[model samples]
Structures are given as structure tokens and as C-alpha cells.
Target: MAAEKSLHEYDVILVGAGISGINFAYRLQERNPELSFCILEGRHELGGTWSLFKYPGIRSDSDLYTFGFPWRPWEEQNSIAQGARIINYMKESAAMYGIDKKIQYHHQVNNANYSTSSKRWTLDVTANGSEQRAFRCKFFLMCTGYYDYKEPLKAIIPGIEDFEGTVAHPQFWPEDMDYTDKNVVIVGSGATAITLLPNLAPKASHVTILQRSPSYVMSQPSEDKLELLIRRMTWWSKPLEHRLIRWKWLLVPFLFTRFAYTFPKTCRKLFGKAIQAQLPPTLPRDPHFNPSYDPFEQRVCFCPDGDFYECLRSGKGSVQTGVIEKVTPHGIKLTSGDELHPDIIVTATGLKVRFAGGMKLSIDDKPYNVAEKFIWKGVMLEDLPNAAFVIGYVDASWTLGADATAQLMCRMMKQMRKEHVVEVVPRRSEAEKRTMTEEPLLRLTSTYVRKAKDMLPKAGSSGQWKARSYYYKDIWMAWFGDIRSGLEWVRGV
Candidate 1:
């Protein structure tokens, strides 16, 4: 009863106080200052993944210029920054914009029921994992990230329990745990595993990266040379230099991705040569660096200043490619009959993809499975009313798409206010739904994505219904495009 009295209400309820949530709040505040909104965060703090993951070498795989919010330029010299720096940046943004005051920490939304008649959402929120309270909002903005934060997806190799040493996942790295002068084996070859290599290699006695298959890996410097040159020149102002650098960062990746898709063989050869140039002369370039798939089929792992290669070259780390037979008391046994005797094992296996942060949803008291719905313009769902979710670009920096979605949502809200519309929903025609190509929402070929294909929404053939990965096109379509197309407008419903 006391919890019921504590029930809150707002014009809009934003779930998750992460990067996307912060961006949305800023944009919405800038556009419509009269709107009253509150952000609900499940954790005790903000920063989302940056604050949650405290692994040895946690860092941003994408450059900061594109990954950062477009409204606020990342002024740091390092494009690929460490996790602590990112967390700090997010905190600074929240503080500077006074967004921190609007966030209710430790309030996790357990369920949401949207009533069409009232055109409002009633959320059952669990506070501090015990007290239950209700919240009502006119509109819902889901800024919850794509993956499950509670648990990481760990492959169950045989006899993992038999290992006597400490086995950990990067998602839940213990703060007090020490790995100095110990043999470490990290499982998986994704960005997390690659990031951990260089950082742990220097401290640990030896670090071995075990992968079932290789991922396309590339290395670039932490600082952008072009950006540095622009900064050095006095001809341009700071704003102009920032825009130039941001566009350069954005276009380079976009063009490279297109080139990889257009001429995969040539890009693959170039990728191999780049890897070979950094590797030690004794190590063969065939199985170690060469992956079975084409470049850009999956996201490429970027190492800052070739730190991973330098660590390997220094004889502190090594890479082994094979299937895991089982885990023994001492270490992991490979299918090729090779046994790795390590004191500590870090499972850097992928994340468990969760939609809408695993919040149960119902529209007009009817159950709704988000996976069964289709994505409209990569922002809102096909039939969801007064709600939008932020899903970023899979091919490029996530914030590029996230920023675009935020801007689009703000625009739609403004339009709705002006039109006196009580409810807005994207509706797919029966013909469009029946004839639409039921492709996986994500276009990447990563293992985690493949595993979560069925859990994700479907993409349509073309036009507004299609899920696009290109930031350039999404910027024009989502930011500048009309909001009336494919949307059903209800006036004072």
C-alpha cells in the first residue's frame, strides 16, 4: 500500500539510463521543454555497459566520434577509449545536462500494459528488487540496450565444473580478484577477448586466447591522424573541425563496409596483408589470422595501435584455434589433443540478446511478443502505439543510428503535439505483412547474432519498413523524412 502511494506519473517514461537514454532525454528536452519525463534505471548507477563491465581491458570497439552523441562531440584524443573514460563521459553528460536528477535508480520495470482507450502505459516497477510500485506515462521510450545484463552467454564445454581454478565471465569480473603471475586462458575471439589480451598479457605470466574460429581483426591507432591535423590548423573553428573529423570517421567505415560487400576478395586480401604485416615473422598467417568467412561478414575486431599483436610478438600471449574437447582439473583439453594448463579461465563468449530489457508487454490487456512484430524505420514497431525503441546500426558505430532515432522520435512527438494526436502507431498493411521478406533484423553473421535470430524482429523487403544498416541513409531517412508515412494518427482518442 505504501509502495502504491509512491506511484509516479509522467508524460513519458524512459527505460534505462544508458547512452541512448541520455541522448533521448537531451534531445527531447531541447525540442519540447514542456514535456515531463523520468528515466528508470535497473542498476544503482548509470553508464549502462560501461559501468557494468569491469573487465581487465574493457574499451569501446568503435571510435568515439561516431559512437558518441552527435550533439556533444567527444573531445578526447583517443577515439577508441577505455571503459572508465566512457563511463566518466556518460556521467559528465548526465550531470552537465541535469539529466541525473530525473533518473530513478534501482527501479526496474517488470511489466508494461498499454491501454488503447486511455492511450497511456501502466508499468509495474520493481524497486530495489523488492518493493513493487506502479508508474503511468503517456508514451514509452525504451532505451534499454539490446543484450541481457544479468548473464552472459557462456558455451557449456564438457567438464567446465571440473576445473579447479577460478572461472569468470567478463560481465561479472570480481573487483578484488587478482590475476598477477597466473596463466590465463580466455575463450572466444570477439571484441571482449581481443581487448583483454593486451591488457592482461603484461600482468599475467602467460595469456592464451582459445577460439573455435577466427574473427576478422584489424588495428588502428588510438588517435585519428586527420583529426589531429585539423586541430593543428588554425584555419577552421572547433565546431567545423569536429564536424569534419566526425564525417571522416563516419564515411571511412561506411565506404569500407560497402567496399567489403562489393569486392570481398580484394578486401579480404587486403585485410590478410594488414594482419600479416603486424604479426611476428615466425608465426604463419594461414590459420592464426585468416578467418573462414569474408571480411565485414561479421564486425571486425579493431585493436588500438596493434596492441594485441604487439603483446603476442613480445611472447606474453598466444592464440590457439580448435574445438574444446573438455575441461580438466588443471585446464582445458582441445579436440586436437592439446591441453592448455592455465590457472585462470575467462569466458569471453558473447552476450545473450534480450529485447526491451526483458520487460513483459501487453497492449489493451492482450499479450504482445515483440519478436513477432516488424521494425518500422528501425525505430518503432509495426503495430506498437505510443512507444519507440532505440536500436542502433549493426554495421557501424551504434550511436550513429541511436542519435538519428532520438532525433526522429523528438520530431514525431513535436508533430503529435501540434496535430493534437493522442495516439500514434505504425501499422503494416495485411498485404505488406503477408508478402514481406521475413529476414533477420540484424544483418551481421556473428555467432551471438545467429543464435538470437529467432528472438529478434523481422525486416521487410524495402522502403519505410526495411531495416537499414547504413548510417548515411538512416540519417536522411530517419532525421529528415516525414513522420506521417505508414503511421496511423488518432486525434483525441
Candidate 2:
């Protein structure tokens, strides 16, 4: 093992050296090898999302063909991979790139205060057994990920807390917790519910899904021939290949998403028919399970390990398509007067998203407010100087955008250094133009919406800037666009 150094700080201070943070570090280092930096990660190891969440059947919902990195071919042939496999890949990347040494394990940064006078940031981080230490640096980059830490959750069920049975959240299931032979009730119908029910089916005596509303579930081939073909072609311009793929998907869903938003019922019928064909003909009819929504409105869940749909074919479990009225001491009571008693309850209700809340950046004695910032090209946050955040793709594999953000950040940094500049931000007018141009795709409200609110660059007075939401357009703007021609470094220019 390389001897770890405890220098006061580096030229850059990165939060969460997961995929985004680690990639950013490498990109910056590649641009300026003389640059010194350190990454502060909350988890004991790397692999941000992959390492933190350890629930059963945990794997990426997105396909690996598009989500996986360009340089390294996914060792796994499958389109989607298991959680453990992905986490290991992350660790492997760190080792391959010598990034592990730059990482400070157990260093959890609570907040950062930026000093314009000194051109540094004082980071308050917890490390070495919760002892808080402050580190100062010239620049701050946050990639802590969007999801908040696991906390106690609440349900709408009446008298639910009184239940004598064990309660667990799929988000933070204990390492030693056992589900075998227990009757479990999974509440909520998002990705977690879709995944948990099947994994618990074999061990649990009975598993019932209680939900208020059902998300549209769409299935795709576990593998894509086009993606396989393209994986070989990624070595070319990363931006070029991404554009080809983005527009390729746009052809099918381009009209569907627009039609769904304009004429909701028509699009819903298209999805309903698809669901009906896959479901059992003899099962009872329930709209909660079969909704009238666009296929990809919310991300669809897939069981890569086993047949996800097969869980329904067998009698091991059932889906209760009704709203939960309340929770009694024993179990959950539905609004339809159906009471489900169980030995354990798992809450898979979706996650709570707080835009800009996760990142606390204080600059020049003033807090950098996300609400006031406009999203530029769906990447950089406005009003922030020498700072960037790498967000994984919501609908696509995070690595798809993860790779793009890394490349673009490095390119911009190189340009800044060459031109001699201290800070750079998107012009408000340009950001507004981009946002307004793509409001339909960039509606500032999806699970990925908070990112736009916090980081989207500001545009013009119209307040409708077009943010290039697609990966291809963003790469061009970030890499090729001459927007930064106006920027002249305050020091040397």
C-alpha cells in the first residue's frame, strides 16, 4: 500500500470520489499534472451509489451498453449488471488509474465555505472516527450524489406503527436482517417495490405489495445489438458517438413523449395494451397495477438476475393494487377496506429529492443559492466560479453522462488555464435561451430535475432558456462552443 499523506490541502477539493468525483479528478490531473488534489468520500470505500446501497437484487436499472464507460469495455456481457459487479468495477477503475491514493476514506464533508480573497474553500469534514477536520483548497467540486442519507420513513397507513412485526426500509436494510419464512408487506410501487417483492418471494412466507398508485412498467431486451455494436465504436469522439445514439433513441420516443404529454389518454392506451399482453389473463383487473401513463415517465425496473415477471406467474406472491388507508398495529388497511397483516413491512416509497440542498456552498461570505442559478447546458451551475458538479444520467446509465461530464469539465479547465482565467459561468441570456428551447424535455421536476434547479445556467429575461438535455448537444456546447471566448482570466489577461 502506498503511504498516505496528510497535507493541509490541494489545488482542488472534491466531495464524494465515486464515479463522477474520481473521473473528474483524473480529467483535471490529466490536464494539469502539476495540480494537487484530494477527494473526500463519506463511505469507507469508493463506488458511491454501488457501495452504499447493499439491498438484495441491487443492480443498475439502466443498460450497461450505454451507461458503461467508453475506455473500459464492460467485462459483463449483460446489458444490465448486478450491484456488486458494478461496485467492483468502480473499485477496479480507481486502482487502474491510481486514484485510490488520492482518496481520503471516511472523510465525510459536512459543508464548504469559499474564500474569494484567498481563492480557497474551507471544508468541514469528519474522518478518523468522526473527528471533524477542516481542509482548505482553491476550488470545490461536489459529486456527493443526489440521494439523501437513509433516515426513518413514515407511511400514510393508520395505526401502522403499532404493528408488533418488524419494519424495514429497503433503502437501509440491515446486513444481518433475515426475511426467510416471514410474511412481508412491501409498501409503495416504485423501483424498490418492483425489485424487493421478487427477491423476498423465495424466502418470505408471503409478500404483498401495497401501493397508492402504480408506475408504468415497460420491459426491453436484456441486451441491445446496436449498443453492442456501438460499444466497439466509443473510442472515437465520445461526443460524436453519443449524439448518434441519442438521436437514434429520439426517433421512437420522440413523438411518444410529446403525444403523451399533450394527449395523456392516447399514450396511456398504448402502454396499457403492452402491459395487458404480458400480464396473466386470469388475474383480477386492477388499474393500480395497470396504469395509463407513458412508458418511461418514471424509470422502469428490471430483474436482471431472475425473471421479474415470473414472480407474478408463480403463486409465491401477489400485488394488492389499492391505496393504503392507514397502518394498524398489525398491518396495512387499504382504502378499499382490505386489511393485510404481515410479520414485516418494507417501505419502497420513492426517495425525497432536495435540489441544491445536498450541496452547501458558501462563496465570498455569501451562500450560493441554487434557486437563483440557471441551469446551463444541464451541467454547470450559474454564479459558481471554478466549480462544477457531475450528475449521472437519470433515464440513461449514469456512466453515460458521467463520462461526458468528466470529458467536458477537463476540456473547459484546459481552456481556462490556456486563456489565463480565474472563473467562468454561462451567460444568463444564453442559459435562458437553452432552457426555453427545451422546456418539454427539461421541465425542472423529474428525479433529475433538482440538478437543473441547482446547476442550470441562467438565460435571458424571458426566463425560458433552452438547456440542451440530450448528451450529444451538451457535449458540443461544453467542448466545441466558443461561449468561453469572452472569458479572460482576471489575473493574467
Candidate 3:
């Protein structure tokens, strides 16, 4: 017979140990010192995405200045960092804040049920593999990121299984796999594929980026030159300089996004010109560099120091635009009768969207489908009590949105404590259901987003339930927005 599971309780429980969860832990601890909390991490390590992904030249597409925690700013000169460095940075932050001790590893939350009678959440967790455990908390916070950790978005390449050459996915990269002097073909035009091209080209005989259509590829420096100039100003302290650099990164991306949306044609022309400047005279900007969508419609892939283009210019890597008719035993066959017989094929297709880490939720024995519901304030779900999840911005550094949400959550928790409220739920009226049109909270037209449209949360046209905007506006709303207007607070049992 199996042993009875142990029961533990806390005032608050965090469901991840990633950047969002670690940041939230700091805010929760600093803002509400009296409240007891614990972080339950499914993985053995702390860095969620950074710790999980292990591929050649895996690094942050976003600059590390804003991607790093706001509390402990990134001190490194390189704004673009590798996955291992990011993991170590996060570890240092957790240790410095003593958040490391509060983490419980190998604790996977499979199901969470909120009881109205008890006004508490009971989480059914699997710890250390098979042993079941139970945890009860007044508030539940999900920092589990949007993508599925266990599965990558399945690339529907016909006859992929028949390929005699080694096939791999960037999500689950095989360690120590050698491709020395071997021709390699990477499928997709996203960040992963772009990153792999330059990284693998030096070692491989040649590399080819196979894509159905091109995405905007921009060149970014690993180190910020403007930051160096700012640091040279002796009037400012190191901390002040760091803050200035951070703000510079934040505003630059924000302004770029605004410009791209406001003047897409102009931005597109500029992007094309920049790309053309890097490409050889032989390779025109028509089919490979030119994108079907405007800039910022989908994410623009950034390569550090024009490395991707440099590889192309050096004749080490190349880009092929076409549809994959089938994967033959030798390699890939294009719909246009061209075939690539590479030694290795890498499917750098996108990620599969997964919410709440795929944990099931229920309230008073009634199942709550997150997909069918609407998100309130980009943090809390409608009709879900004492629960909040972090969803970061697609355009800017994810940490910016996460920290903003943390501040908002802290404010809500403080208000609840001040009023002796046990349960707080975001309640929307029937008029909202009828009048407000449904919109996708993830405002991207990317293939991955389009494929999982039915699974994401709904956004309203206006008001508190409207779709999430840019970081600056969201941060403002977080600090001073309406919190009690559409909320129902229960004080006592």
C-alpha cells in the first residue's frame, strides 16, 4: 500500500522558479513580510526556459539589460548573454535575496482546486517522481511560462521519418552531437533557426536555413556602445549608470515598436536596406530577405553583430525559400523540384503554447477551463479567486511585464490583508459577455500563435478586460489602475 501524502500549508504559493517567480518572491517578501510563501518548481533547476533549452549558440534574443531582474541589474558588458550565463545570473539573484531557500524542487503541481467553503487552494503535486503531496495556500501564483516544456510545436514535414540523416529539434537538442564537416539544414525562419545558422556554420561544412517565408532579420551588437559612453560620465555612480542603460534599452524597443506600427512601410524599407547592406551582390533581397508581413507584425529575429549575415557573406551558410514537399531518405525535397541532401536536418520550428503549465484547475468541484475564460488585468482570470498568472509582453523584455504584474499582485494582496478579505475574484457582468468582442490576448500573427488561437485566453475590446498594451502603459495601470470596480471580495467564512 502507498504511504499517505503529507500536507503543508502556506499563506501564498508560487508555481515556478523562473524569472517571473523569483521576481514575484522578492516583491511578495519585501511588500508582505508577514505572509508565508513557498515556490514549487517542477524542474530540478531554477532557471525555467534557460535551464531547459540546451542548443548550440542558445542566447537571449532580447537585450540582457531589461531581461535581467530590475532589482539586481545586469552588470556584464555584453547585453546579449548565453543561456548558461543567464541561468547563473538568476541563481545569484535568488541567493542574494534568500529566495533560493524557499524553493521546493521536483514538485510538479498536476491539479489545483479552490474551495469556497474553506477559502483555500489545495494543490495535488507530484514530488520526486511518483510520491504524491498536498499543499494548501490562501493565494496561488502561476509563473509557469506560456510554452509547453515537454513538447515542441510539431513540424508537419511529410516523410520526415524517412530521412536517413540525423534529425533533431532545437527544443530537445542532443548533447555532444557532432556535425563536423557535415552539411546541415535548419527548417524555419524564427529566432531559433536564425541563432543556429551562425553558430553551426563555423563547425559544419555548410549550413542552409530552409523557410517557407522570410522573417525580418536585424543585426544587433552584443555590447551596447551607448552604454559605454554613459558609463564614461563620472558624474553618475555605477548604479545610476546601470539604471540609465536599462531605461535606454526599455525605451528603444518601445519606440521601435511604436514606429513600426505607425509607419510600417518606412520601417520595412529601412529593414530591407539594412539587410541588403550585409548581403552579397549575388543574393538579392527578393525571396530570402524580403518578408511577406511588415516589420513587428511578427518578431524580427536579431543576430548578434551581424553574425548571421557574416556567415552568409563568407559562403559558410545560405538561405533557401520554398515549401518542403517531402523528406526523402537522403534529405529534404522542395516543392519546386529542388532537393537538399544534408547530413543533418534541424527542425527549429516554434514552441507549443501551454498555459498554467498544463495544470488543471477547479473551483468548488467545478472545473475551470482557462482557454474558455477571459484574463483580467493580464494577470488574473475572470471568476477565478485568489489566483493570478503572469503573461509577459511579446514585443519587449519579458521581465518588464513580469515585474509590473508582480507589483500589481502585491498591491492586491496588501489591499486584501487590509480589509481582512479571504477571497477576491474578478467578476464580469452579462453585458460584458454579450457586448464585448473576443480578441486574442497574445497579439501576434505568428504561425504558432495562429495554430493555438483556440487555446489562449480571450481579451475584451475595452476597460479592465481589454488586451494588454505596451510595458509603459501596463506599468502605469498596475500602479494606479482600478482594482475594486469589477472585483468581489469576501471577508469571512
Which candidate number maximizes TM-score?
A: 3
Clash totals for all candidate models? 0, 33, 0
| Residue 101 lDDT (model 2) | 89
Query: How much lDDT does each candidate structure score?
Result: 0.88, 0.65, 0.92
Arrange candidates, best TM-score first. Answer: 3, 1, 2
- As for model 2, its CA RMSD to the true structure in angstroms is 5.3
* TM-score of decoy 2: 0.83
Candidate 2 deviant stretches above 4 angstroms = 1-7, 152-155, 224-267, 354-359, 426-465, 485-489
Deviation of model 3 at 51, angstroms: 0.5
Candidate 3 per-residue lDDT over residues 1-493, each given as its tens digit: 2323488899999999999999999999889998999999999989999999999999998899999998999998888889999999999999999999999999999999999889999999999999899999999999999999999999899999999989999989999799999999999999999999999999999999999999999999877678778889834598898889899998988998999999999999999999999998777889999998998878888988999999999999999999999999997999999999999999999999888899999998789988788888888999999999998888888999899999998999999999899999998887887888888888788999988877778887867888888989888877898888668988974
Model 2 weakest 10-residue run by lDDT? 456-465
- The sequence of per-residue lDDT tens digits that candidate 2 reaches over residues 1-493 is 1112332677777788677777777777676676688888777888876776777778777665455555554545476677898878877877888888899888777677777666567777778766767787766677766566654334455666788888887668888988899999888877777777778899989887776667766666654677567657875666655655554443444454556667867767776776666666655446655654455566655555345556766877777778777777877777789888888988776555443326467777677776566554456666666666666654555765666776776776666677766566444555444644323323333333443444433432333234445565556665676545323234432
Model 2 gets an lDDT of 0.65
Q: Residues 9-128, candidate 1: write the lDDT tens digits.
A: 899999999999999999889997889999999999999999999998799989998888788889877889999999898999889989999999999999999998889999999999
Better of 1 and 2 by TM-score: 1
Candidate 3 ranges beyond 4 A from true positions: 1-5
The predicted structure with the larger lDDT, 2 or 3, is 3
lDDT winner? 3
